[model samples]
Structure formats: C-alpha cells, structure tokens
Target: PAEVPAGPYDALLEAAASALDANDFDGAVQAYKNVLSDDPGNPEAKLGLAQAELLGRVQGMDPQAVRKEAADNPGEVNAQLAAADLDLVGGHVEDAFGRLVEAVRRTAGDDRDAARLRLLELFEVIGPEDPRVTAARTSLARVLF
Candidate 1:
C-alpha cells in the first residue's frame, strides 16, 4: 500500500509532543487520544499516548525509594515493574529493558505475563527501530523460551 501523507492530525501530534515536552502529561495524552480517535492505527499517536501514560504513572514516584524496593525484592513483580518504568523515564533504557527481562525470567503465570507485556509497551515507547529495544526483544525472546 502507498504511504499516506501526513494530514490534519499532524497538528495534534505536534501539540501532543509539545505537551509532553512541557511535562503536561494529561494534555499530551488527550492530544494523542484525539489523533487516535481520527486515525485509529496512527503509530505516532500510539507511541506518544503510551509514553504520556507511562510518565503519568510514575510522575509522583520517589525514584530512590522505587529503586531500593526493586533492589530489595527481585521476585516482586510490582516493585520491579515500577522501577523499570522509572528507569526508562530517567533515560536508562537498557537498564529498564534488562530489569523487565529479568522479571519475566524469574516470574511465572500472571506475573510473567505482566512483565512481558510491560516490556512490549516500553518497546513501543522507545520505538521498535531502536537498537536497545532490538537487543531487549531478543533477550526477552530467549528468556521466554
């Protein structure tokens, strides 16, 4: 199929990016959702909304505490997930992926699935083309199998 040119929603994408840049997570999420409502499969809007929502989840967290909790509870899925989110938002992309991959390795059933799903979501936030995400995907595949 021929690639469709950018249309009217480019403005909404720009607005979402601007809101994300300014730390207005709610605004960013809303703008991205507006674009998604019009273009349901819009990749940029999906990525932006995922990032905005992830940041919103961890916005009020104390990083030091989160990290300590994760470090102290390697088998705790929630702790590890929270720390991984914090790591990604803090620009420690590799660390975030590694942590979640390990979480998947150590967990089973629902816990394992949660870790795996969150890792995939982070992949979207980072974009699949990233080398780090590629490496993480390989690592996740290995651990899962």
Candidate 2:
C-alpha cells in the first residue's frame, strides 16, 4: 500500500484537539485559528474556536464567587454573565440559559444587548443543534421583541 501525505492542517488540528482536552483554551483557540486561516469554514476548527473562546473567558474564574456575585447583585450584567458561564461549565445548561434569559428580561438598552449577546455565545458553545439552544432562542426572541 502507498503512504498518503498528511494535510497541512492535520498537526494543528491535532494540537487544537489536545489543547481543548487539556483545557488549554488559549492554545486551542490559536491552533484552531491557524487551521482556519488555511482552511476557512472548516467545521471542526470553527466549533473548536468557539468552544475555546468561551472557555477562555471563564478560565480563571471562581464559580462560587461568580454565583455569589450574581446572587448579591442580580441586576449586574457582568455578574450575571459570569454566573451563566459558571453554570454552563458546571453542566447546568438549563440554569445558564435561564440566567441569561432572565438577564435579558430584566435589563434594558446596552445591558439587555450585552446579556443577549452573551446568551448567543453560550448557544454557540452549546452547539446550534442543542435543544436548550432552541428553547433559549425562542425565549430570547420573546424577550427582545
């Protein structure tokens, strides 16, 4: 059998996957971006990049602190966002979605927009096909308009 040559992005793809597995979100994001620079619209790289970016934002955050801040100040958009991120990372997907949705409902103008944008990012992190995203999207739309 003849040996096949490796694709240019193969190593980078592997590196990105490894980085993601190790929770090295910055490395994964960079590697995924490198792969994307070569092969635009690559699904794996796109998804990996989204995941990495989401994880990177919450990298050094303390979940308990975030939750407490949100609890202490429900109207604070940043605190709510951090709490939602913690919920998502902790596998409380519905809780994360609900938090953002409530934020969207309670806030106005730029604060509402910020919460909505964060919710969309969480949708990406959860993948478009997720039922939670679908439900949240509907709820978000209701709140927006």
Give the number of the best model, judged by TM-score: 1
What residue runs in model 1 are displaced by over 4 Å at the alpha carbon?
A: 1-6
Candidate 2 achieves a global lDDT of: 0.90
Per-prediction TM-score to the true structure, in the order listed: 0.86, 0.85
Error of 1 at 59 (Å): 0.8
Query: Could you give candidate 2's per-residue lDDT for residues 1-145 as a string of tens digits?
Result: 9889987788899999999999898899999999899899787788888788888988889888888999999999999998998898889999999999999999999999999988888887788999989999999999888
Alpha carbon deviation, residue 138, candidate 1 (Å):
0.9
Instruction: Please identify model 2 stretches exceeding 4 Å from their true place.
Output: 1-8, 38-40
Per-residue lDDT, model 1, residue 5, is 88
Q: List the global CA lDDT of all models.
A: 0.95, 0.90
Worst 10 residues of 1 by lDDT: 3-12
lDDT, candidate 1, 90-125, per-residue tens: 899999999999999999999999999999999989
